[model samples]
Target: MRRPSLPAWAWVALAAHALFVADARAAARFDAATRVFRLDGERVTYAFGINEAGQLQSLHWGGRLADGDPLGPAKSLPSHSSFDLSASITPQEFPAQGGGVFTEVALKVAYADGNRDTVLRYVSHTLERDAVTVRLRDIALPLEVSLRYTIDPGTGVIGRSARIENLGRTPLRIDQAASAAYTLAPQDDYRLHHLSGRWAGEWSLQQRPVSEGASVLESRRGSTGQQNTPWFAIDRGGSSGEDSGPVWFGALAWSGSWRISIDKDPLGAVRVVGGYNPYDFAYRLAPGERLDTPVFYAGYSDGGMGGASRLLHRFERERILPGGGKPRLRPVLYNSWEATEFAVDEAGQMALAEKAARIGVERFVVDDGWFGARNSDKAGLGDWSVNRAKFPNGLKPLIDKVHGLGMEFGLWVEPEMVNPDSDLYRAHPDWVLNFPERPRTPARNQLVLNLARRDVRDHVLQVLDALVTDNDIQFLKWDYNRNWSEPGWPQLAPEDQPKVYVEYVRNLYWILGELRRKHPKLEIESCSGGGGRIDLGIMALTDQVWPSDNTDPFDRLSMQDGFSHAYAPAAMMAWVTDSPNWVNRRETSLDYRFLSSMQGALGIGANLNHWRDADFATAARMVAAYKQVRATVQQGDLYRLISPANGSPRSATLSVSPDRRQAVLFAFLHSQSKGMQEPAIRLRGLDPRQRYRIARLGGGALPEAMPAEASGAYWMEHGLAVPMRGDFQASGFVFEAK
Candidate 1:
């Protein structure tokens, strides 16, 4: 993996120029003589350069530097032992497989001539206002790799990805590929934080010390599995806390089968490599063909875990979400799943809609059982037509009724799945992901359609297009109930069958993009049997996401807490369902339920048909109260004052508006025994100079000694006391700047 040496004078000139020429206003800069590139954000700077051996190396990735910080060239580290070569010790920006490296290679390929090693060297580069693309070529092969770097000016987050091209005359197989590898500076102790859980229990924050080996977080279930999310944060031991300390965080903007490996070399160099999972993964590129990796976004925060989350949330809202930097607020939705699961009909739905409207539900959604013979999950999954038996006049009458009641209409749809007994499945049995002579596995009584196929992709796009076009549908609860079983693409050559992992997701994204382009007003929610398919990739296409199917108020508190670390509240949909919840039968008070759901995009999933007059009144009052502070909850900086994790008896959250005009606080007490007293809730992210008027939601009494109005500084310093006496009790307050 050696390369021709550059002139001695050239190296000296580049080093001299890079050390002296640094513009504070420039987002990106490159030193050609030294072959160094630097991207500067508001508070962070990422710099990399080529070493003498012609490999791209990471230089600096932390706090912002001054105009002349003296960042020298990328030098390869000396080998500590015979087993650890210089190439393995140096933190190459995008390492290839042929350099005697053993940590984690970013790119690995199998050539047509039976070669399996690839060593990429710097070739050329391109620079832009906020981006830089560096080209690398195989030392002796026609395989070229282009690495891209972009930074968000407001949130100091850097996005890295790679493009692999086959410039040879024959085809080549990519055995392993990653977006990019990030190297962390040497430190004494590093603790890694990630999210992991099961179907009913998702987003459990898990942490461990970074040891002397590799820790891999991945999803091989075709979509972003509920087992582990594609996000990670690391902080030095002893200094990490909820609100203050140094932290580094990143998330992979990929929804398909993906992997992120955090490795600590024996020499103590820590690196993070992430991209398409190499588990049964392969992509064959023909001559002149290319494959692009997903974007891996990383950021640094000196404010601790809370600071890291806040930065990521702001970045997702302004950069990743669908609304061009200003997405719409999540509407107060009423889903009729709990009321009537498989008994949905026009009369029943209209009655439910009428009751929902009385309670001020802005959007009425009829979930499941409205189309085909979808009486249950066992049949009629792929049949996209309306059921004549249930809807004799189609969805028009119900949609019109909902509109007339001053509410938008939404429907449940599972376009990527088909039951074995469905008409679509029977007609095109070959459309599923199956081997020629293998049994097609079924989960939830459905099989995943081979969306990687062009025909199947077109069919799904066409049906969804027509459904939205024919009806006044404002939203779609797009769900994928199962993962891939026999992910075989028999239509393509046998050698290309393994490409399903990449093509399936690409087509899915394409279909969603096409649907949105066709119908500008239509909104979509990504649900995969609960928080199974949520990530930056899916967030870019959909408006909101169903975090989990288990809507029990108490269970959701922990899930929502973990969810907020990586995603924005605007995209997290929380629903208030009937108590004596089906999942755990945990019965909570109506007010408690409302307060829990009100933390995020609020929704009602309770059976209004069974509710008494008192229930309706309570719901109406809560809905009205939520509307008053909806903007702040949906689009504001969140502060988790007291975490509900580890069986904590009390939990509290505060949402402060972006402009600092208003702040909303919600506090919950799991149980109080022996008259245990709780501490006052101090708020954050409020302007200390402004005076605020405190008002309780739902007409609750304030603390006896506390004033009704006070300066933000006084409130923050003195705090406010709220009552917490019984189990499952909740309270909310609105602090309006006066």
Candidate 2:
């Protein structure tokens, strides 16, 4: 009963040591003898093996299992006549739509011999560190398929893709091919969660119960449309809260048209499949030709939706995004789109640049109207050359002014779209996507360029290259403002018309890659009228994405929540625009707007000229505060404490730095009730024994009668109260280990 007590510092050190060990154990691992793949990041396991019939069967996918415990005890085959109708009654690793198995199929191939039958049998497998490839072949035909699975041990994100080769004598057509098919063990109740919206209102999260039949979400607009996002999560109806329960989730890494199907079979078997949209899609594989599907990533989380999101965030930082290494802290930008849209001139831009720099902006972007007959959205799009009338001395004068003002310069251009009124379209009408005899349909008065064509692709690259070289451009806002209509290439043979979808994306990637090679320091943002093309495919090449055309901060709350479900905050470009907001005309406080936009890569899209001296001061101060927490907010694990969709009066997000020493909280109270008390929010992802100092950042009062410092354990257990009393009020705080 008489042991020497350790000092406070010693105790803190011991706690930090234990925290490191716990975090280290979260990495994923695979057991060969047990045939169990443990995704320890979420404490989940996936066990699978080939049955005696040489078919890959999914055995287990859920919470971690003991090393020697068998997953999914063997069940005898049914004596009823339904045995033939079911595919062995076991979860299939990759099921085809044939053979009387009525569940969702992952692949459908059409052969030249007028047969569409496919019966795959496991042939061989190769396993490497953190990756595996399982080969399968047709039981009768000469078709070969291989399933590739790669896992990022740190994040427990399993990436799955398929490779199909035409080993037969004739060509084969891939009528329907999914990147991956995931099946979860039967649960009492399943709820499917996804995002759906249109235009100014995009990425609105919606959750519905999984029913007996099938529910589908897809984009057939030839691009990742604003109508639907290609990501989903299924909870067992156990917990609806953001930070609780078991949830399974996946997202397709495709920027083009895609489809995701959630099917609940008769036996209550739930399966999710996703890949390229097969509608108007037919990939012809010639003899010896092989097609590789995009990667589909899936993960399991016992800590619920928030856990799944943080896993994806870490995976994107460590494994997905590339910028010489991990993506750097995104610069705080000031874009002039809202200020001088289509009215951009050297003098006006220079004046705006000075104001932006005065407000502590790190980047200044000149949006639209700087190029080719472009006084309006209807005129110059594809013409990348500067408009002499607007930029009389070229973009050089404005760019130099921005550089001298201590900010990098960026320009906006829709390289993939051409206005019918533009010089480029007038000279090369056939270069646009159109059938020989069909009328060309235009959106935004612009035609989609046939990037699938060699000439068109080359022209886009040349124009962009010259712009960058001549103007010393450090950044380009590459936009795709319209969807594909009359998608056809008459220059190609009739049989090869479908190649437009495949080749267009390929050529875009090539152009981006080539430009990157030439200008090593150049940065680009991928925009499709905003949030139209935000997907992992485009994310690989671009620095960030404009989530939506609506910069109303309140709307962005839900939009960003949905966007971050499958994407990292670093890739979600959120802007702070003027109030009496553009779309909703809902007036919000400047601090509220700043805090909302600060949740992601922060940028200012407000018309600086309309701002008063106080507004400028607030903007400058908030930008400085953002800089202090930029790295942590962009790269840390995100914990959504309160959901905006729940119609709550308040919403909060907490970001914990990689190290357990720092955390930042951005809390907003949309509207306060007459006698409502502020909620006490619990903090996560911290060393419990370590004490932290809580300090306010912007214009917000601290909790009433609360201490400025407390232990992490106390913060998590008892929590800290957020102040209340106002409509559209927001606050930010930082917690540092004391």
Candidate 3:
């Protein structure tokens, strides 16, 4: 008898089986021999242990914890002085403002008895399949704090939060409360990476070295303002590049103003604390009442900044976004904001809709100016009525025409604001958020509505609900365009005046919930003058976000890069608008614009009426091609091969399908210098042994060295070289397994 022959896949399966076992053991494991608990994903691990003092100690996070005794005690500490007496050297899991240390505390609570001391000591802990809850109590006060840690099995993202309960007869005032406190072993060379921008320049990446003092990244302008995003990354030794090194990162899930502080002690130890901005913030908790902080998600990666981003992307898609049913694919939408601006009308919108449908647009959104006296940004806010002058028969005609063209219809609205010139404001001047005697400060001629008021909240909800129900609206671009100047709610008591900041966001969330409950089929996009309100809180209800008001493809490249660090591509709505470009006036090719926008949730904001025949033909073809790879690009693992920040003329990105059968690559050349050579573009996340067929999407001309077919291993190892030249040029390709 002949020996049985095995197929090639048999060996592949054997190799994968070992990986599966290793992954399972490291995913979330407790080593009884070492008395340590570890949480691990494919490329990272986090380990910690409880010490003799019953406090969490020896916290270490990095690539993998395969060494011995990773849960050892801290070997270094700052000298204790008569002025600041912080004695014990072990890293704290959650420090409170009592005795025991002068380092920054994560929680600060005040009692009705006028005592402001709070010393939390660990009492007990319980571990579940995906979560662990640690119980702590003040040394004297009758209060209990529970710290919850939940690790996502797929992305290894640790979701952290705190719940504080008043176990005493009297009430307690929480002066400051953070969701989690993360401590790192003594290291002096760590660098902090954060995002900072304003209005049209949101989410611009910024980096600085971590010094001995505290570095605070916060947003105090009501919503998650354009000033600072509540996410950060720490890279030690300034050596972490886009694709390699040790990087620890985190993001808060609150839509209201937030704060994250990184405090580096004199001894080189670092503690990261994050949650709602406690500045001018105080929460009153009566007896038996509990306050829960928003989720603060943190993760570690050895694969550098890119790896940390990929982990976040996966977690956001699988766990954060809400659709309540089958996830909808983001359509190639055509927005009329740039096309018509404040001059939109029924006939004008119908003409654009005809051209949009011809170019294979899936959604047609009529932007501003279709409402009551809204000919400009100076008036007509907070009025949800259709303008009879613009549309004599209301929105039914435009809605019918859009549906007839086989496209979904969307409307733009800034429901959280009111213009002083509008009838709504005249009828209820006190409805705006303002002090009784303070002069109202208007931005873009608008004031924020007091959403915290019950009547105001109910009215906004009712108006939105009626619009969706009556007009058969499928989508809404909900916008909040201004920051709060004097956010005073006279309706509430003086003690509750500060409550406006918190209640306004809570009311916004309530309105969103009610809207979703009524119109399950309707999708919403959160846009605050663009990207101002993008965060985990709003993301839970909205389908997508407009990343910026500046849509210049070059500017968008960096903007989109910074956005992907904390968000998924599926939720990033990128648009290809008319060029010269509206923001920068940098002339770019039509293909370049489309390719840039295709990197995320694709949309077109260019005026179709002004497009030439050739432009329309190219757009139609590109739109069809985008639909073919939309799922892979939106949901696949992202690999930042080349960054645009390095001053190099070229930038490259790759995305691989989850099943490992297909991949897409996007390369851009901002401006090539003389005698520069085309760089090699490597691929990732593929079955190395399998053969794949390569096809170009829209790269002007193919490189002379291009091959039609190659093995995945060869593609990843040797890489493919594409010919690139000229300023503002882009190239794209798709690889499919044969």
Best by TM-score: 1
- Local accuracy of candidate 3 as per-residue lDDT tens digits, 311-350: 8887788778885333467999999999899999999999
**All candidates in order of TM-score, best leading:** 1, 2, 3
lDDT of each: 0.92, 0.82, 0.84
State the lDDT of candidate 2 residue by residue for 6-117, as single tens digits.
9886766566445434544544333433333333333666656666555667777667665446643323234236644546345678887566666778889888888887
Ranking by lDDT: 1, 3, 2
Model 3 RMSD in angstroms: 7.8
- Show model 3 residue runs off by greater than 4 Å: 1-58, 63-89, 324-326, 699-701
1-738 per-residue lDDT for model 1 (tens digits): 874598887777766465437544668888765567889987888999999888999998888887666666778888878999988889999998887888899999999999998888999888787898999999999999999999998988999999999999999999999999999987878999999999999999999999887999999999999999999999998887888888989999999999999989768878999999999999999999999999999999888899889899899999999899999999999999999998999999999999999999999999999888898899999999999999999999999999999999999999999999899998999999999999989999999999999999999999999999999999999999888888999989989999999999999999999999999899999999999999999999999999999999999999999999989898999999998999998999999999999999999999999999999999999999999998999899999989999999999999999999999999999999899888888888889999999998766678677689999998788887887798999999999999
The candidate with the higher lDDT, 2 or 3, is 3
TM-score of each: 0.97, 0.92, 0.91
Error of 1 at 169 (Å): 1.3
Please give the lDDT score at residue 560 for candidate 1.
97
Model 3: number of clashes? 1
Q: What is candidate 2's CA lDDT for residue 149?
A: 82
